[model samples]
Target: MRLVRAGRRAFTGNADVLADDDHRAQVTDYFADLVRPFGAGPVTDLSGQSYGEMAKALVAEVVPAAEPVDLLVLAFSIHDVWPGRATATYLSHVCPGTPMSFAVCDQGSASPFTGLRVIGDYGVRRALLVVVEQGALPYESAAATPLAHRGVAMLYEEGAGTRATEVRQYPDVVPEAVPELARRGVAELSTGHPGARVVLSDSLAAVWPDHPDHTRVPAGQPMTGVWWHLAGASEDAVLVGDYDRDLRYLCFAVVAADQSSVD
Candidate 1:
């Protein structure tokens, strides 16, 4: 059965959000510009906080609506990273995918997990994340979906090891491309709505990773997922900010066969 493609944008890892400077506007303004094009459908904007509360509101706003596709993006500050699980839950339950895109703000003084490493055996292959720092954000999804932060994503690893930076902890969810989840646990619907394929990516660059000088990764390895890149299918582009250290966040762009070059 074809399902809708869900994506997300979060400010959980944005160091700028937590900055004491009066640039809080960056957090608010960026969000506004990002979501301006994407009319509300199945997206969660973690601008301020109370994501739990936000979830409840989203349910009320978009429930029993045919599982609409979900797209997330955020330029976070401080309240998001410490409890990375919040964003994880939002992504895991709300939007399904491994190595999900993540844009975190790290100023070398603060960490998303607040002194704890979010290295919970989870791999980026499960979901590709992209972190952009001091760089402007894109304004479109690779799938051509109307979203904030368009264009390509740059990869980097900044502040690999430092006393000021702290590692963080994440949820214990199995983030990989499984054929059918093999009934191992509950099967999450990648798309909140109905669609032939679903692609989730960030429209812009929103994270400043712990290691920003790392070499850029070309693309992400393929995993199990819905056929988001089918031929003759109306490309449903759901765009937002992808905030992970890996540049695979934009992998959602081209996964289908070359239409003109194929049978």
Candidate 2:
């Protein structure tokens, strides 16, 4: 799939009613406790923004082209379980005359990558992929990582815009495979853009090689991989990889918009 336009929004709005000052304080304490156990820094703030609101903000940032979107695909983290049809239903309202809508879940942090595959497989002329993480509240199993509210929306077309050259997954998810998988992924990326570097996920920061040409997206935001490669960084093509221990999945992709071809 090729990228047409991309927009990102980070919410710093009111804390969720459930995450009131007192509750947030408790969450902060828990966050600190998990820091030693989890080895990730505490997530400081929990945004109160609803998923629908953040989705709207993200879409508003994109200046739509003359072409109508053929499909809208929503991708989110496991922390967001608002409802089964919440996203499709809300987006249908926001996007009247919607052609089609769908949501990708159950892949956890890898849902966005799956959403990209959906765009490619659907063969749509134009599609929208929106991914958001509103800081998983301090539920029983949610406080292990730091928290932050961020959303990213990318428009894709079949043969136009920035091309996502390759999206693949490896079966190795053990801690030891991180460096080898990441190294191999980046090496594969270099086949096309020989000078290509990488943007490492925070999870593999410690094990990955000390490359002077890599950017490590911080731990908190789930979709940082997409945001960093598409909107933030200037790499001609970037290799983004993340490992999910529970699922034993290692997902990575190489995306480029600079008219470069994977020859």
After superposition, which runs of candidate 1 have C-alpha atoms over 4 Å from their true positions?
1-47, 65-250, 253-263
Worst 10 residues of 2 by lDDT: 254-263
Which residue pairs in candidate 2 have backbone atoms (N, alpha carbon, C) closer than 3 angstroms, thus clashing?
43-146, 43-147
Models 1 onward score TM values of: 0.21, 0.74
**Residue-level lDDT tens digits of model 2 in 96-215:** 236488778777677877877777888877778888776555334443543667778877667654445577676647877777776776677667666555666766675555543667
Candidate 2 stretches with Cα past 4 Å from truth are: 15-47, 63-65, 79-85, 138-142, 160-163, 210-212, 258-263
Each model's lDDT comes to 0.26, 0.64
lDDT of 2: 0.64
Count of backbone clashes, every candidate in sequence? 65, 2
lDDT of 1: 0.26
Best candidate according to TM-score: 2
Give candidates' CA RMSD values in order: 18.2, 7.0
